[model samples]
Target: MAEENKSCAFRTSIGGQALIEGILMRGPEQQAIVVRDQEGNLVEKVEALKFIRDRYPILGVPLIRGTVNFLDSMVNGVKALMYSADFYPDEEAAQPSKFEQWLDRKLSSKKLEGAIVTLSVILGVGLSVLLFMVLPTFITGGLLHFFPGFPMWGRNLVEGVLKILIFLLYLIFCSKQKDIYRVFQYHGAEHKTIFCYEAGLPLTVENVRIQPRHHPRCGTSFLFVVIFVSILLSSVVFGIWPITNVWLRTAAHLLLLPLVVGITYEFNRWVGRHVQDNKLAKVLTAPGLWMQNFTTNEPDDGMIEVAIRSLELVLPSEKGKDEW
Candidate 1:
């Protein structure tokens, strides 16, 4: 039954992330993030967004779409994260100043949120720069004293390996927390629920439980692909740099991230759509699925219910007329 359902594609094409204590669902037209608060009631926020492609058709093109989508997702993901964090009354969130609130009273909700969105994007970019640029450069620069005169390729290989290792180590560390584990379980639930829908099965807890949590198009899989793509792209770019300074090479890697992410996003899309029928897709994506074992645990029905409710809110009204 599961195998047969896998052949069908008409379901929902939306995707989401399990945030701090909530679920965020992103659809074609609008996105919603739903969180269960301390009062045990669901708090939901919906935002309507226009895709860059809709605004500028050229951005929807192959290579361009990947880059645009990556940035768009990052921006939206942060907003969803902020909304999800609001569920905890004790959570320390940045509140608008009195002056800003006064302005918000006069301005529209859209204007107020637009300011928040801009700030969030700035913070996200700053965080990425610190992690991917500064940290790697510092670590790799320190390594050079012990292994001097290595070729440029060798140094780049070290940096790439360290970056992947650091990323994995961070995941491992975070997965140890009890709250994070529960979030990971919900992450698993999200994947299984989507699988059930795509398989043309009723989106019930029982059916979703039987489906695998590892999805080909998952963020986990995408991250793994990005790491490898970074290694390849960074090596090619780094080859031009002299072997003298690790900081220079690391800086180059950071600068090339958009291209690397763009390529990986396109590759992931291709593999995800073809995985069910193509043997090679399965092979390439196997590591990602395996890695998901560390990231996703079996979720209970309550968690699945939360996922379902979150998904239902974001699905398009005309969803069933054609294949997703």
Candidate 2:
């Protein structure tokens, strides 16, 4: 834990996502994806990032930027994942369905990539809503019907607990998969490399290996924070309005999700900006840090190399430009 308190001169706004056999790092001005190809060579793709806020100033506002950035990250992440997967396709993987084949033939490569990314983002958001928002409300509402004596607060509590349990179970199941475990290992590598960079250490496998795999600014922590904020917000809303209809309650939760995400993102940013030894920040971030155990795994030296290369490619040209 003492090592966790190691300080550096600056905190960075750079963040990343784990891809199939690769790591995607996004700095303030650029993004890079580095994957280890089957031929045992590192492949890197780097591009300048154009922020939507540059053209649309309104989206740059604090709470509003959170939602915008979250969506942007999702789109970029899906694209990078697709790119990384292309390098190591499984020969035995299932063939595309007739409809998929038809779409592939009808759409050009660029169009197909855009269409796939759009659909992926929609499906991903829908599934999140179904599992975390709708399912919990449905389950808790069913319990309330069967047990009329169940109090309103109890219903909220049950729903919140159910949401968290479902998330944890999902993470556990994903972590157990052979392919996903490798991705989680890359996730750890991404974190460790970022930690090493933040600590003002040289980007080397040995240095990264000793750094903490769990980062306060991780997307995993952002997700856990979202769940927590949703739980609290839902409880307060249900308490005030006392809605009993399950579907209506689910709709309300869905409507509140954007706000929950915004608040959680801001909280994460605040925690990220604080020194690691700050007691209040540590207490606030503890739960998310604890949850990282399922989302990150120790990485091999090869994985660390990929992470290092990715980070190096995306580092801002000017020092302190990425300061939190």
Candidate 3:
């Protein structure tokens, strides 16, 4: 394979993401997108990513910086998708597929599409509030009604139990989708490529297939941290829920999201970097690793090839700056 023959030229740690009909790769210096067009030809685009850290040192601080990084990634990802969409000709665009037609009919306008996406995210948070906050509160409040004398911490205990149940069910349901399964296969491809590179193996499809699919720095792990952190943080802040209003409690949870994400980001980063030699790091990451069974599957060589090309386009030419 080309990756094996040109191993030394490739950046070792660059990673990739599977997109709707393409791949996105992020290297130290640049991010690249590659998509298969309607004509089944590969089209690629590359962009240099200059971080604010180069100019303002203070902006690079841990917690403060993650928020900006998350937001930037979201915006850039959308732009990359839009750019790739251009590869499909106007005639092809007019005869939209079921998903495209659905999106078109529902969104109607670009502004409407943006609004819908924002609303969808908000609705997701709203559902989380409904499950973790309102439903749990109701259940615990009912227990209080039954016992007529339960302590303050009892509410938090019940809420935690209910939240865990809700999270588990959500994952189970989402994992059942056919398209989601395909995406998960690509997810596995992403992890295996990173693993192959980290292990000093030549980054070929055959070599990558032998590498593990579970990645400590995965978004899956970040979510596990969010759930676990919510439990811990809520135990402190929402424990005495009998004394607080529901709206106030929900607001607190919403506000704490950035903190949770930032902390999880930092932890996952540490775990990914250290899991090679550290038993404790592996232990901490076990749940997320197990969860990958539902979120990742064996990808075919074609998918891996797309991923490899995506990674190649973004990799740094310079030494000592090859992280994905």
Best model per TM-score: 2
Report the C-alpha lDDT of model 1 over 1-324, residue by residue, as the tens digit.
Answer: 247545765545588888876788887777888777777677777877577788799988887788789778877887777677666645443676799779788979887777878788878767765665567767887877787776777777777787777778767877888878988988988888888878767878888888878777788888888888888877776676564565566567677877888899889878867777778988999888777877888888877877777777777767563233
Better of 1 and 3 by lDDT: 1
Model 1 regions lying over 4 Å from their true place: 1-12, 44-47, 91-116, 240-243, 319-324
Best by lDDT: 2
C-alpha lDDT values of all predictions? 0.76, 0.89, 0.69
Task: Point out the worst 10-residue segment of candidate 1 by lDDT.
Answer: 85-94
In the range 1-324, model 2's lDDT, one tens digit per residue, is: 237436575688898999999999999899999999999899999999999999999998888888999999999999999999999887887688798899888999899999999999999999998998899889888878988878889998899999999998988888889879899999999999988888888898888899888888888788888998999998899899988898889889989988998898789888988747589998888888888899999999999999999999988889889988
RMSD of each: 3.5, 1.4, 5.6
Cα lDDT tens digits for candidate 3, 1-324: 123322233324465666655778888888888777777677778888898777988867897676666666666655655565566446745776897667767765776657655665566556766765567656665566666566668666776787767766777787899867876777788777776766566679998787677776676666777778776877777654444444565677777777776777677667756665578987898887777777778888877776777767875688567743
RMSD of 1: 3.5
Error of 3 at 121 (Å): 5.6
Give model 1's TM-score versus the native structure.
Answer: 0.84
Model 1 local distance difference test score: 0.76
What TM-score does structure 3 among the candidates reach? 0.78
TM-score of each: 0.84, 0.96, 0.78
